[model samples]
Target chain A: MGELRRDPVRNRWVVIDPERPDREAALKVEAQPPPPLSGPCPLCPGNEAMTPPEIIAFGESSRQRNQTDWSVRVTPDLQPLCRIEGDFDRRPEGPFDVMNALGAHEIVIESPQHLLTWAEFPEQQLERVLRTYRMRSLDLRLDGRFRSLIVVKNNADAAGILRHPHSHVLALPFIPYGIEEELRGCREFYARKERCAFCDIILHERVSRVRRVVETDFFVVLAPFASRFPFETWLLPLRHASDFGKIGEKELVDLASLVKRTMQMVGKVLGNPSCTIVLHSTPFDEPHTHDYHWHLEIIPKTAPVAAFGWGARLFVNPIPPEEAAALMAQQM
Target chain B: MGELRRDPVRNRWVVIDPERPDREAALKVEAQPPPPLSGPCPLCPGNEAMTPPEIIAFGESSRQRNQTDWSVRVTPDLQPLCRIEGDFDRRPEGPFDVMNALGAHEIVIESPQHLLTWAEFPEQQLERVLRTYRMRSLDLRLDGRFRSLIVVKNNADAAGILRHPHSHVLALPFIPYGIEEELRGCREFYARKERCAFCDIILHERVSRVRRVVETDFFVVLAPFASRFPFETWLLPLRHASDFGKIGEKELVDLASLVKRTMQMVGKVLGNPSCTIVLHSTPFDEPHTHDYHWHLEIIPKTAPVAAFGWGARLFVNPIPPEEAAALMAQQM
Candidate 1:
């Protein structure tokens, strides 16, 4: 098990997962030329034995475990950042607070094949992937020990060592500082205007249309007004949905289409740069409040994050959001 | 001039500096075979005209400006993220807050010989570099238009495009979110303990000595209790100082030696990996208070920051700080 330590001054928690494989060694493994496409891939079909026992698989039969028939499969992380079996065991070491990194680290294999990229997946397959996300989020919340579920996809080698199309689901024991801030901001906005902050953004973006890139019947894609990175875009549902697990089949399909199209546009413009797509939703155990709105954010890895960004937490984006939206809109 | 836009949801400001030269183009330029070390090095001797007119230079005579005799020189950024000439014309754009990115961006040329890394510099030369930082910081705060001065060094190609040994001084009209959080955290700790949070940390680290990597007469280098990155070390002054600009000659020399030694240890352990050194101090307009303590944070670029860190503002440091400190202390 790993430990979560809080910075004495910043008051933010850092997950110090010593159990995580050596990062340098992981990079070395990734730097080596990948094996041929037909080679053994743990996430691919017929290689299910290479991974841990499957927790769930969306296939013709739920009875069949760790088989090649599944379109989307969920399994435990080979080297989990945090173990699911341990108690939080919160304690203080001297002046710092420490706790067991108790939660679930699972991988959601997006497809059965060795398809390397998510953007190339068909819309139906992508919808199944999104559905699997909803299912796992809903399933993980039943464990009272979990406070938040973070769903993220490291799309390419630039993002991480994972070349296979997969997304991660981390059931965290506490609300991350970033999500807490967003929730606080939303609640504050609600206290003032009795409206969701994200809903207001959607209304404002739709009215302005300058920052809007593309929209489906249920979702809207636009560049964030204060994008931290170039080509940073958000996919927000038109409906006021706080929990991603509450997404209906129609909304999930629409979301899949919107995500696929937006990603394709980003790839076309940025020349298929590596990117990270994260799903941000209301924390588990939180009430169905009207203040919060869930969304997906896609950040293309266009440039290295230098000291200025890391030090100040103030990002200097060379591309204006309006210009980025317009550029993507042109492709749409 | 650039614009600063506020993320209404996250309540953080982002600098959209369109005038910044395209980063891709800059990388392309750097990718080309470098010119000879002595050939037309902009930061070297006889190249004073290559940069913008020197704002200040320290050498044999202080009166000489833009001359090759200067051991250390300060000049305006050729492509500044924010310009000093403009007023921060604040306004509201629908649901967002906006202002002109009005501030100062300057570069401190560390050496006249085009030394690429600060780690190789002698103790005396490093002390002069530290002195230049204090002088420029004090000078910039006198303008009254700036709220914070962020001094950072991007050491080596991995950190940035600048190949010459130099650091950046960015004077911003508003406090960055990162600094704001640290100040808030310190204030909260002070409210509870009636003592400076960092001072308490210094006492604790000294007493425990587990995370302490190096201890000099005036400063202590230790891996922070909740380091966000591997081999992340902080250099804290023994005396209570809210501002870096207040350092005296003795403290400056001591800090220089401490920083050099810490960097050497890090380089030795990490094999000279590119790193970033950031100076965190009190805001310019804030009065001297016990609620803030200045320090230097060095983050080695051992691994790429993936989606989890970017989206959640939660860092998953693979190496435990205790282990990291022990590794560095082996060399120290």
Candidate 2:
């Protein structure tokens, strides 16, 4: 089993899972000319055997488990970050904290066809992908050990593990520092102003219009005021909500449309830049802080920033959110 | 003037400076095949006029200021992350915090020869580079606008802006969340153990010897137990200290040698991987936390992990630190 180790100097944990797939092997695909984009992939319909058996799938035609006809499929990651079967035993090893790397990591294969990304997906297929995300998020919460889940998609341009279009459904056994700090930021703002910080942001961006890329009935896609990367964006729900699993069907439909359209708009501007899109929500076991709002952060990966970011935690973004928003909005 | 904005959802700040080379223009050099190493480099001694005028330099036989005989040089970054000419004004903008992107940023040119990396530098040259780092750090503190200073070097392999071996001296107007958390982690551990957390880590690792890469009278080069990346290393001073600007002359020389040797050993194993090396210390104007120890975090930038990390704050390192330590240890 892989181990979860706590950082000695910071409130952080890393999943050290050499057995899952060594970094060398995990990234070996990149060494070769990517085998052509729409070629045989492990997540493709016929290659069901390559990945773990399907946990769920969404399509109008009812297909049996592990069938080829499904539009979107969910399967256990072949190289999971943390294994599902383990005792979440945490103990102190001298001065460091160590634990069993226990969690559920599943891949939500978005489309059977590798050619279509979120930007190119049919509206119905995009809705199904979003619906499947929520379904798996709720399903993973049933696991007693997990506390938080993030639905994450690293674009093909980002050199993700697979060329196939998919998002990872990672149910972590503990809340991450990012989640903790976000919650604290919200609670602190609410304690002072008696209002949700995200809600206030929606209000401010709506008035300013400079950072607002698209404002729909249910969702507003805005470039964050303090964007860490060029063309970074956020999909925020106008209606106050902390849990993604609790989103209404009508709202989900609007969110799906807005998300697809926003990505397309951003694509037109950046020529389809690689992006890491993470949908963050409240932890499963904790009592929900009303001020905490679910959000999707779309960070476009510009080259060499990561190397710079590692050394200095202070982010230095070149393109201001206002400029990024204006550039993206012009695509509309 | 550039602007600094606080993240709406996290206790984080970003310096958004479009004027200091927008991301597109900042990366234009990458679009073309890089100029041949040691070919018309700006940081070269003869090209002193190409960069901001020399702030300092070191060599046994010193030439006049901005002359061509220096082993190492210091100059203001032609495109600094934050400018030194701004008033550090901070205010809340609705729900978000806004501030002037005010600070001093300088480049520590480690070698005049572009082809000479730290692993290839002469022993004396390496010592001069380290000495230059300490000198610039103490000099930057004379400014009243900055609260924290980080002496950081991103290796040439890391796709740093300049091919010349250089370190960035970034003095921030506020203590970063990373510095804050590190101080807190040390304080909490001290509250219980009444011993410095880093000291205990040193004691524990020395007893184990598995993660120790090298140890000298003044310092220990270690692969941290919870390394966020493969072969992530740290250089810690054995003697108790919480500030990098306060290191003595002999200790600095010893640190330089150990740093050089450790990198060479790591180079032999990883085939010269790109790395971001950051020297973290106590924040200026803050009382030193007794349990906090100054250290250097050397993160080797493995490809594509940054993409995955952007989505999942919980790091998944395929290589365990123990195995990583053993790999580097074998090279020695």
Candidate 3:
């Protein structure tokens, strides 16, 4: 039998079960081998009939057919948290708690080629991928039932189950509690300081320079001062933009170049690390009156959360962000 | 190169570095069989002289003593994050933040037998372990320089590098920013409700009984509505209590027994899965009047933070806590 341990520092709890006998063996059970690069993945172009119907598709000039000439595609997820066909039963279970999984979940096929990533593509093709995300966001926001629309790109084999590089966009009927907490935090800071917390953080990091991992014309990537994990980094817009959809064509081009550069930098240092890129934008239908700043975060898997860390809700990082940044910078 | 991905929900950043790989690999590389139950294991009872001098010890009496007769022991960590000897340097150098790792780190060797946990121990033995933790907390509180004192137990191999079933205690000179945020949240709730938020939550969970995982004479375990991971459970006192240091002797025995039962239940269901337990308590020298509720969080090692989760700080759990509680209830 395992013991339950408490982290006195963070006041978090973790269960310590030693019964596995081979604690490391648990890793192998989920250690899915990398998928083969070759062959016809249904997500690949010309395999349009193989997948669910495309919600939106961008193809080469003079192309009318659905799958054959598409550059970027959007379709309903085969397995979705929120079914598209449901009546959205918002039946009440109790007071202070409402229930229903009401939302739209879709997958964005970033490229026609199965093997290539947005970064791996030429600049023009990548721009079209960006365009598809913005177009979807605009369409999703019109529903009014959704309190928020989020677009996330979980790239690489380590970050996602499927090897093909793609992104997810979700339209939720309710504003998630976590996002509300963040908004509250940001609102409090902005009200007191009369400045955006993220902007202040950006300026602080730029001045400090020690935590920076990558930088480009429109954005700067750096590790946070109070990083929750080792080697965790975020990409923030240099300008205070509340909406990702509001980013112009020039900025999108710049973002594409920077994404490639940042990914290249990380790949060099960590060797095709598993990572996620999230678009933290303002909630839908609401006027941009709060201090929320849009950004993206990338995490490379480096250390496993051990029992103490898991139990305590406190993370003990062996490497500091400054050390991580300095190491990555040297590689660059 | 791994491109940054975004989560459409909670917008927290994660890193996906593939270079370091898994900690399981590290264990294999060491090829260390679990240490023989016999011989000079520093944590074992008879090997008292093998470890650093005792900070606190029990059994035969609460008074400090020579090594041989002790049943429970506490000592300064041989390798500590905050060493006993260090300069308190808080300065910044050319864009780099620097500070001395000023804090107290120690280990509590739970049993002299080296084979039993608090759950496995007799009532009298478990009571003593709780008493020692209280004494240490009070003593550490007097250090005016420190901001918070956190005590934790990392039992399984997944909890830490060392496989020993031991717990740790740390006192930091700085109150971490994360803790500060939580404090603010707790206070805000209290100010509005004129009651502790945790107290209200406990009452709510007890009445609902929907998310409750376990109940004992002294404790009740449940899952938070906004659980970030599957099977994330919290064990709390049935009655309102601000600090672990203040639990009475009768309550201590009950709590220990409860912990044992909980562990066994978890083992039956998850095959003694690797988990973490964290203890949350009031910071040293702080007023007990704060609307804080000290509790323990137990997190099971269910899955890794994939790109979307890591990138966006949003978690998409396939299983809900209500469903998870039902599964756990079966084991009970």
Candidate 4:
């Protein structure tokens, strides 16, 4: 007789089953050994010849297009979600919305080794990764076809997936509605207050120090007051920056350190947890988005969003963000 | 390397985890042995004595404070996400937005039996279940505090942690932003054409006879052209009705038959697959939503959404709705 229920926050619905059993049994039965690596692993340095021609790479001193002595590599996705072809379709059939998949999707191999995690990369290597992301984003924006460029990292094991470490970058032709709403919300607040909403948030968190997860010279990681998910945290730059791809060279080192340190802290706190990290940037096609500040969101896989959360679009946040931040602060 | 990507249409992100070893798993696990019924199953008939007094019920029902003999029951949630208490404290404390949790959350016991699915119930019993939903919704709207009422059902193994079947109902004080966006989008379309958007969609599907998953006297289920997820289908009425709770008795019987028959069709087509079913109704607090028709969304758990899909709020639908409907039509 376990009944279904709806949460109002996100207007999503979930069915509440009254007979929940222990969840650990499934994990126990599925902890099989890792699959053997056969053939060429494109991420491995020696396998460079096996992948699409490198788009960008980092060598001993400066940027390198293609050289064996590389520390990091970036290449076009083998199976891209969006191809670099097609005449940006703008036709609409009655009420149905239609658009062309005009964008660039690329993959960044963080390390030459198959086993090294993105966080395990040295500071220099991490800085190189950031450089590649920025360079790619800048180049894509020049096409005027892409509205925005997004950078994301998918770490398995924490996100209920296989254990692997890599990140991705995508340039899109349209600014998503959700992100647009966020930008609008921020812009409205800024217009009224004469200051950046996120900057104000950072200042408040600095003073309260209640929800600060980790702090670096360039950035501070904290949990949002109204987190949509449990253990949801964010990394915001201390300085007010509209675009992630435009960070100063000096700030790049600090950003890299902050990112690496945060990932390590996450590994320590969640035990090498599987998680998703996303870098939200300004829509390139929309130059008037100065009100939107770029940031990164990291969601740990400690609690999977159930039907109640998904169906209703309402978050049943068991662990409040403030409390979660306190836990992370202690570990950091 | 696994990377995150965003889908264009639904504006959601998906993660392609290069690290995950399990690319494809079981679509839906078989139901495990029912949990021992000793823990006071919150949804059982006697459980009425455990939850808040019933709001509505059928079948030899007794109005006594904690009596049983009920086939379907509705009760206040033991632990509600939004409480029906105190004024909504809406204030901006500097940059942070805070509000008191205000609303009503309740559960719908679909069946008196612990193991029986709503689909397995007889046509009359299913009608009774739907009647309970509509009656309770109408009654809840009488309370001026609620802005909207949502009814949701999660069935099968893919959508549940507990093996038992159940549904949920919520009376929200706030008109959710997501639903508001849809209304705004539809209203804008209506303003231009002076016609209901959903009605036009219905006519299109009716004429094309493609993407129609199931049709009934009062209800027609179809896969939307711009589906957010794979196998994401909608159960809409043939008539242009805006309010589901306002449905008459005759329509209720037809809707019940439609829902039950549709679930059976789904089971037959997908091998008794699990799915989430959500009902959308008109807002009680906001008027002029009469132009918006109420419908139910049934999304089968086919694939895991990646970071690009979840993070960027984009979606990548691999299966076209028309194709999916054709598959289901064959099974039916």
Best by lDDT: 1
**lDDT minimum window of 10 residues, candidate 3 chain B:** B1-10
Lowest summed-lDDT stretch of 10 residues in model 2 chain B? Answer: B21-30
Per-residue lDDT for A184-244 in model 1, tens only?
A: 7778778888888788889999999989998889999988777666678989999898999
Q: How far out, in Å, is residue B175 in model 2?
A: 2.4
For candidate 2, the iRMS in Å is 18.6
Of 1 and 2, the candidate ahead on lDDT is 1
lDDT per residue as tens, model 2, B41-101:
7887678889888887886564788888888888887766667774545566554656666
lDDT (tens digit, per residue) of candidate 4 on B1-332: 32223322233333333233333332232443444554767777665667787666665633564577777777776656666667765666445545666677777777777777656878888888788888888888999978888776777654343455567787876655455655665677677777767788887787787888878778788987676665677888888887888898998888888878777766665556567788877788775454688888887765665456555676555555666788778876
TM-score of each: 0.88, 0.87, 0.81, 0.87
Query: What DockQ, between 0 and 1, does each candidate earn?
Result: 0.19, 0.17, 0.13, 0.26
Compared with the true structure, what per-residue lDDT tens digits does model 3 show for residues B1-332? 11111211122211212222332321111112444444466887667777788887776664446467777788887556455556656565432244555567788877776554343567676666667777787788787777676666643434344555667777766554335445566777777777876777778778899988878888898876556555677788888887877777777777777777676665555555555666777766674455887777676655553334443344555445666677678876
Better of 2 and 3 by lDDT: 2
Model 1: per-residue Cα lDDT over B230-268, one tens digit each? 677889998898999999899899888888888878878
Which of candidates 2 and 4 reaches a greater DockQ?
4
Docking outcome class, model 4: acceptable
True contacts kept of each: 0.30, 0.21, 0.11, 0.17
Model 4 quality (TM-score) = 0.87
2 versus 3: better TM-score goes to: 2
Deviation (Å) of A255 in candidate 3: 1.0
Candidate 2 residue B205 Cα shift, in angstroms, is: 0.9
